[model samples]
Each structure stands twice: as C-alpha cells, then as structure tokens.
Target: MQNISNSFFELLNKIQEKKKGDDIQQYFAEVADYLFKHVAIQAGETRFTFAEIEFYYYKEGEFEGPLYNCTYPRTRNVGKFFWHYSGMDICFESSEEKKYFGGILIRSIKRGSEIIAGPMRCSDEIMNSCDGELPYLVYCETACETPVSTIRYGIEADKNQNMKFCFYIEPETWNRKREGVLVADKATGRYKNVSKTDYYIAEPKKR
Candidate 1:
C-alpha cells in the first residue's frame, strides 16, 4: 500500500510537469491513458480481472449524473449497467454463486492548460451544495470482483488553485461490507433506497 501511495504521487508529479496547452480534451485523454497504464493496471496486478474502463464527463456543477460517457472495449450499451446502479453491494448472482463487482472512480479538473487528477472527496456533499455545474474528468474501471486490496489516489485544487494530493488503501474488511440497495427513482431518475420488491432483478433470488 505504501508503495502504491508513492507511485500515485510520482504519477501526479509527472502529470503536473507535462501540462502544456489549452486543449482540455487532449490533456484529459493523456491523463486517462496514464491512469489506466500506471495506476489502475498496476493496482489490479494480483487483485481482480480487469473487465472494462469508462470515462465520464460531468459539466461543472451539474451532479444529477454524467453528461456523457465513453467506454473502452467499446459497446453499444454504454451506461446501461454501470450508471444505472449505485452502492457497493451490486453483484450478479447465479444458481451456483454470487459474483461481486467493484471499481474505482478517479476525478480530474483543468485549470488553464494545467491538469490535476485524483479522487475527489466528499463527492455527494459537493454535488448537493454547489450552486453551479461542476465539471469533472472521471476515470472508471470495472473489475470481475471486489478487490481484496484497493488504493485510491486524488489531487484537488482549492478555490485559490493550490493543489493537494491524497492517497489511501482500503482496510482489510473493506470488501465484505454491504452498502445496501439504491434504486433509481422513476420520476426524477436519481437513486433512492427502496424495498426489495421495488428493486428490479433479471433473475429471481434463489431460495
């Protein structure tokens, strides 16, 4: 975990030095490539099979959901499975067993030509209180199962544009915890807790 933390900081330093122009898209693409190769790939080395990668664009201050998304291993179904589900307990169950799924969300922002990428903390709170749209460059990875070990890295800039970096690994029992069920509201499309009957399941729960 310590080594992972060190690598995240090193990557941040490298990104900080490479920011060159005003092309936000190009800059974000470069950052995403680095994160996939340097961070996500390395972290998944012995943990879980890499399923897919996704990039979400959130216009500044609008938190209802991402404006659009691009998925690697491209598919016609972009946001079908992922964005529709919220919470950590999401899984696929078969008669034989239950296969859990887990992933990480890395957020980034651009200030002038420079780019800063890392996990954005207190995401829910920020979305609710902020008055305007908040833009985000979010990198997402879907793994075959919840990883036994996980590391998170984030770099954020304050109102004054001072950058701060944070990195941490999940505790031993992180994978065993259940975050409960959240179903999308029919009227608003926002996720909300609901009774089991309200939850839609393609396969009925096994007896």
Candidate 2:
C-alpha cells in the first residue's frame, strides 16, 4: 500500500484502476480504515485537551473559551477515534458575514518505512458520535503540512456572536504545538459544510 499521506491521491488511483460502480466507495472505505488504525494509535493513552480559537474575518484572535471543557480520554487500544460534528457560530457587527463553516481532520499513519498523513474522512460511527455537538473539535497527529482544515458550512442570521469559527487548536499542555483553524458558521444554527478556502496559522504573539 502507498503511504497514507497521499491516501487521497491513492484513492483516486484505485478508482481509476477499478471499473466497478462502487469503486469510489470501496477505495474510500479502505483508506478510512487505514487512517483510523494509525491516527487512533498515536493518540495513545494520553488525555487530549480540546479548545476553540475565535477568528474574525480570517484574522486570528483570542481563544474562544471552551464550549466543551474537560480533558477527554485518548485510549490507544480503542482502535478508533470519536468524531463529533459540532455546528459553527459566527459573529458580526454592522456588516460582513461568514458564508459558511466546516472542518476536516488529518493525521499521519506509518506504512512500513514511510509515514503518510493527509486529508482523510471519518467513519459513520465516528461522525455520528458528535451528534448534537455543534462546533465540535478533535485532536490529531500528522506530518502533513496542514493538519486541521476548515471551511464555511451554511448561512445564518447576523447576530453579534463572539467569533466566526471555533477551530481546534493545540493542547494547552503541549509545549511545541503549532496553531490552526477548525470550524465556521453564522447565527443560522444550521450545521452544513460549505465552501470557502482560507488557511489560518496560529500566531505566537497571541498566546
């Protein structure tokens, strides 16, 4: 098997190689399983802390205080990581609004001598685990340049919400953690992944 870092590309290759109608689905499933095995293991027996960072129109701001406070368990033997799809909240003053907000988790997995980590999808069980948890966030370990990915989900009303996106940032305990964005949405209260491609890096100046 090729490295999981290029799993997306590998999936495409598999699809091209196979002529079956369910080719895409089949390859996707295989890739998902492979990623889960590796990412979940690295999570190990440590307690993972999750927090959301507030973003104002593509600029990083203060930590968005924890919507879900509590260090979650990351048991290595679980064999899979739990995923929660939390809805995004957006804040606006007089003008400007978020088109939508969404997030994708990426992790690196060891394949023989190579470590591959890229954009990978979660399983139904994992995705459904975050039910009713709007703006949910999770921890990941990957060598991919961009670990956490976010996008706009849907449109909502303009209420002076605190911030726009609730991104999953580094754990407060990790001494060497880089910054990144997690999720986004408006006051609409609707949780659906929309499209707005912009990457946010964690600025050291802002604690």
Candidate 3:
C-alpha cells in the first residue's frame, strides 16, 4: 500500500502528471465515439447525436445512511477516480467536439438541519470538538466495458451488501502507476492528501 503524507486536498487539485505522447487521449476519444454511437444506433439513426448526456439518481424521503466511495483498492488504485470532491469527471473526445461526462451518486447527507459526512452522522456536539480534519469514505459505482474485458451494466443489491464500494477501472496499464500523488508544493513546501477530508465532504464534519 502507498502511504501519502500530504494534505489530500492539495494533492487532488494539482495538475495531473502527463507523459510525452500518451495514448490515453486516443483511447478516450474512441470510447466517446463508441458511447455516442451506441446511444444513437439504439434509436435507429446514424447521423444523430446528443450534445450532452446527463444522469441523475435520487433516494426518496429522509436519507439517513452512510455514503461510501465505491472502490476496489486491492484490484485498482482509488486516487484516479475522484475529480474535485463532488464527482468523477471524465473527458472524452466525441466526434468533432470534446465532451465531459460526470457522475456523482451522493449529493449530501443530513441529520435534521445539519449535514453529515463519513460513517458517523455529525451532530452539533461533535462539530464543536473537532479540529483540523478527518477522512471519510464515500460510495461510488460504475459499469464499464472495453473490447478486451467483460461488459456489464446496472448495480446489484446483493453485491453491495457489505456497504463497501466497487470500482471499475480500465486497462491494467493505467492502474499501477502512482501519478496522482502530490508530493510537494513548490511555494509552501508542503504536501497534500489526495483523499477527501471530513470537513470538505460535509459542513457538519467541520470544526
């Protein structure tokens, strides 16, 4: 396991390290084309396409439960999936245009008027005592397929029984590299953590 000793927020905001002549762009372009065509073809049209594709999920009534970021730490690194703390933002080249597809499962967690983060619901008493920041796990899930691997869709209730998240990573080549680590800030000489801080995830978690 990799141990990061920096402020996680700073690390996540740092510009991603890019190598010369990386083919990842080409791959995303192909994926975008495939997804766009897949949608249009289903409608029996070859020349039609959407300017954007949006998806949203909501739970009715009071949602009082833990939100975890879906991950398979043993199988894939969790750092690459988070874009900003809100959701996973992926950019793909679609035909003649560049498009972004973002997904976020949990918007906010609340107990009464106060918002909560992490496994424990935040209360007024807890907020007054905390200092600095604590880390919290959030749930994330996705269905992905490529020409080389298994293709599947939809979230299964039984597989998520444990409350731990399941992550779908593409290409074994991209999973092993530790590129997201923000080791040092040139101006402050401090490192940042790539993981989400409790306060950053919810207002109630803040001190």
Candidate 4:
C-alpha cells in the first residue's frame, strides 16, 4: 500500500496532472481515510498550544488571498481546538463567509517510516461514533472539481456522513491566505464557528 503522506501527495499530483486544467475529485477513499486517521487520533489524544489555517478564493481561474479574516489562532486541547466562525462578535474575517465552524484535530506521530491515522480515519468509525452529539459537520471534497467551476466542495454533511459535502474554493489563493481551518480563542467576546454553519467567530461585527 502507498504511504499516507505519499497518498496525499499523489492526490495533489493527480489533481494537477489529469485535471490540471480540468477540475476533479481527489478520491476521499484514501485521502479521507488518512486525514481521518490524523483527525481521530488527534481528537482522542493529540494536544497542542494553537495553530491557524487559511482559505483562498478566485473569480474563475485567477486566485488570490491573504483575504479578509483568513487567519485566526487555533486553541489546541487534547485534539480539541476551539474557535469562532462568525467574526461579527469575535472580529474575525473570512472571504468564505462560513456559516458553521468547527475544528479538525490531527495527531501525526511518526511511527517509524510510516505514518498512519487512527481508526476513525478509515471509514469515520471514530468520527461517526458521535451520532446525535455531532450535530452538523462540514465536508471537504475535491471529487467534484471541474474546468467549468474551478472550485471545490466544503459543504456541510451530517454526522452520518450522508448528503453531499460541497463548497467552492480556489486552490492557489487558498495556499496564499493560509486562513484558519479551525478557530480557537478569539480576542473578541463574539465567537464564530459556534454552529455547524456559523463561520464568523468574532466578538464584534465587521462594520
């Protein structure tokens, strides 16, 4: 079997290769599995101080970022990072206008030459374990990128993993902004990502 990182690298390569000009899906069968592995383990055990992730956007082909409200500190707990989605209260900003917000904890401890995810990474056994408690969750998918759209899906999927996980985002700009994928500890009293659809995690509304 291909190594986990190797699998992700391959996924990225495939996107630029066969679908370089054409949008395509990055087969979650493995990528999801691997990402989940990191996520599950992190959720179950991983802990850290904090980190930030960013997202970018584009018109059709052109992409740019460092977009407004793209970066935020991610409070790390035992894999549970905290942050708000709607900055209206917290003062956070994001071009995506994420309605719901959540964190993705990942624990990648190099086990020798190979890096494997936890059980949840496989078929979401760990993540799915939550059931009623999970509420709403966002789903990231590249299995639907295309030349016509030039975007990817980050839709909200339920705990069952049912429904389509689709949200549009430009790759190039995404790299540049490096916005927060997870929010935690906002300087403002307002918080975003409090809901599955809430994106703004701020204390003050952007005026």
- Best TM-score goes to which candidate? 1
**Candidate 1: pairs in clash:** 60-133, 60-134, 60-135, 61-132, 61-133, 61-134, 62-133, 118-154, 118-155, 119-154
lDDT of each: 0.26, 0.27, 0.26, 0.25
TM-score each candidate: 0.23, 0.19, 0.19, 0.22
- Candidate 2 vs. true structure, TM-score: 0.19
| Superposition error at 83 for model 2 (Å) | 20
Ranking by TM-score: 1, 4, 2, 3
Over the stretch 64-128, how does candidate 1's per-residue lDDT look in tens digits?
12111111111212112222222111111111121112122333222222222222322332234
What is the lDDT ranking, best to worst? 2, 1, 3, 4
Question: What does candidate 4's lDDT look like per residue over 39-112, in tens digits?
Answer: 11212222111111112212213212222113334322221223344211111111223321222222111221
Q: Judge candidate 2 at residue 155 and give its lDDT.
A: 13
Q: What is candidate 4's local distance difference test score?
A: 0.25
Q: Locate the minimum summed-lDDT window of 10 residues in model 3.
A: 40-49
The TM-score of predicted model 3 comes to: 0.19
